[model samples]
Target: MQETLFCLRVGHRLPYSMSYSNTTDFTNPSTFILLGIPGLEAAHVWLSIPFCTMYVAAVLGNFTILFIVKREPRLHAPMYYFICMLAITDLVLSTSMLPKMLSIFWFNSREIDFSACLTQMYFIHCFSVMESGILVAMAFDRYIAICDPLKHSTTLANPMVAKIGLAVVLRSAMLILPYPLLTRQWPYCKSNIIPDTHCMHIAVVKLACADTRISSYYGLFVLFCVKGLDMFFVALSYTQILRAIFRLPTKDARLKTFGTCSSHLFSILAFFIPALFSSLTYRFGQNVPLHFRVLIGNVNLLVPPMLNPITYGVRTKQIRDRLHQLFSHKDI
Candidate 1:
């Protein structure tokens, strides 16, 4: 069955109006109008408040994690290194969309340059893929530490960590490179108005006059290859970690060991669950309200960045201790 395309008309209050004519050769409009949550424009102001707060929190939290990790000698380990990478990825992922989205909500600054939109699309998806890979790396770090304590240091040396980081970067960049390239080639003559806040891949590509099956299929392929493989490895690592924890000599030892993994487990759930749900909902939930769908999309990107640092700060003893010491010294 062919996917049904829904064309949204810009409301009268929008600064720029959209033309839904049947023309097929416009290729690239100079600017694409972003309609921030169709049918809920009136609440845009109120909505911006929470969105802005989350963006601010995300920035501050991630930067704090990076600062603490960098300043403390004890944190110069494989796990902390991966944590820093995750923080950076979260920052990029949230920053890519929140500012522009806040502008749309607060000032009606909804017009995005075509090329710029594609660039934003690329960054958002690319970093999201990187985040997934980093999560897997973090999980591997946990597995090595718990299951193979004696060789953990030798197995995940600085050189090995560098290699893992390089692989994650190259993998995401190479896989998501095709999205903008493929999207740019299509003729977007159908409409210049995107129904949601950001230039999501499908949302942007669907506007093109040409068949979008190629982009859609490639998207699925990347989704499976990156996120799918990452999830599988993470699950396998944790499974082994769990078995090791159980075989420990005593109950207290089991609890103590599991505590170390609790933070990573929380971060994984926080990152992937909403992300997968939002993507699936956007693609298949035809009966879902536009506002609800858009809100989920924003939440997946916004919430994880803000939540990850907080989760680590509270759960990781070393980070919490460093945070306390750093602040206490300032108070003196």
Candidate 2:
């Protein structure tokens, strides 16, 4: 009776279905059905409204940062350069996930082709790593400016800074390119249902029937090597920056130092805290609630892009003032 029901629900035979079976045998499943967003049905307009709003806001916020940095002559500096890179990264990163997510929400058609899935995974990883590298570059720039003020011009001169920026882009691109290629090569015999909305490395990997030990190791290695190392450098740079700030003679100078580092620090925490939680959840999957997992995953993807511009605008007087001036001039 159970077998009959399973076959009926699966729409023919168990072998062609993407649904998972309780039995030990894993060979029956072909594709995976992503249990779309927890409580929101695909056709619910109300549920998708918030996601649409976020997507629009994320794009506009980051794009405005890019525009301001490009148009404002005063913003044409090492700091803004890194910020623009960050904005660009956020734009690409959010874009890679949001459209597909919205489609799933609005249409209820969560059936992403295998190739599309791979492409989405590739870009998501690429832009995410790029954001991490750009943040590290921003921290390093602050470190040099605070710790070595006299040589700031020489240390971060146009040619040198440009080269560094290029290197950051190149490194992130190369590091993330291998994962998609490797995953696509593996044979997938298990159910294709990706539990999450987006194509995450862990969720996609877990769908494989073959041993994913190597892929898991690779994911860990990249996490530690890229995100972990970037965090370490950011911490060290901030430590030196703090020491330098304390040595400043005037209260104004001290305040200036704090103001300069504050945004970067906030941005760092925003990016890392959720990431650490996601990694922890990934490692120990048993006890966590599904909704919490979904929430964390969405935050991990969304917050960095949205918070980045806000952080800079709030913390940097120059950016804030420039924004005001730009809007005021446009009003005239």
Candidate 3:
């Protein structure tokens, strides 16, 4: 009991603890403490309601979309397949973010082992970039479907969709694998109290005693290559899509064409807007309240997954028809 007490107290101090701090070189720390949204400790119970709601909705929403798409013959198109990939990414993202966060908010269970923390960071980042890639692919799908409607089937055939899916997965895994490994190589000496809800790459990297410039720069490089390139292509594709939409002779044709993109546009905005905002806030909003920063940081993870499926089900006619057939005991 005494030994356990000693370890807990020491582990709470992390690499800064006396025994661990004596040497600059270190193997691993006892544990990392995740501070769940600073200044919200008193309201953790109340805050967990929304977190739990979002988590459940995210899981259900994504899985429902996946099931409907997979089971229905009408949804076998490349667009739906890309959406399935997105559903999978949403599953991973919500799984990566919510479990530990809920545990912290509900049970005050904050301590995480070193290997687990690294693993969590790996999945979180990998899925995030993969989702970004899928969004870009979705944009291309929209562009082809709208601008080159006659060639849509040929352009995004099953083989092409499979290749894109494989590429997205491989790219994400390759880019994000180094992040956890980099953090693993660096020794933590200051503290292990990560002032965030989950094991984020930046949060963990910032705790290392070693020079983090390489890791930081490498992160930024990956960020620009994956998300930056994705956004650029998406913007370009939409530019072409808009150009095609306006060229249509009838006003009804323009509205019909524009309506087809509403779901994807909503999805892009939901995922990217909060994500970029939170990242900027994290980097530059030093004066911002920690709780506020934490909330914004988490918004993208929760909101997009819950909303994306609902948006598509409501906006896209094929999905809506398929869903209605599924629930109403009719054929799609």
Question: Candidates' TM-scores?
Answer: 0.94, 0.88, 0.91
lDDT of 3 by residue, 1-332 (tens): 33234335423323334434423445577677787877677788898899889889888888889998988887899989988999889988888978899898888888888899999889988998999999999999999999888999988899999999999999999999999888988888666667788888877888788899988888878777778888899999999999999999999999998999989998998988787777667666889887898888787788888898889889989888878887899754
Better of 1 and 3 by lDDT: 1
lDDT of each: 0.88, 0.77, 0.83
Which ranges in model 3 have alpha carbons more than 4 Å from their true place?
1-25
Which residue runs does candidate 1 get wrong by more than 4 Å? 1-24, 330-332
What is the Cα root-mean-square deviation between model 1 and the actual structure? 3.2
State the lDDT of candidate 1 residue by residue for 257-283, as single tens digits.
999999999999998888888877777
The reply for model 2, stretches above 4 Å from the true place, is: 1-32, 39-47, 330-332
Q: Write the per-residue lDDT of candidate 2 for residues 1-332, one digit (tens) a residue.
A: 35435445433333332333422354433334444455444234665676667767778888888888887888888888888888888889988987877776677666676767877888888888888888888899999888987888888888887898889888878888877777787666545656567888888888777888888888888889889998999899999999999999999999978888889889999988898788779668669876568668777888888888888877788888888888788641
lDDT of 3: 0.83
- Return the lDDT, model 1, position 231: 86
Q: Give the winner by TM-score.
A: 1
List all candidate RMSDs to the true structure.
3.2, 4.0, 4.1
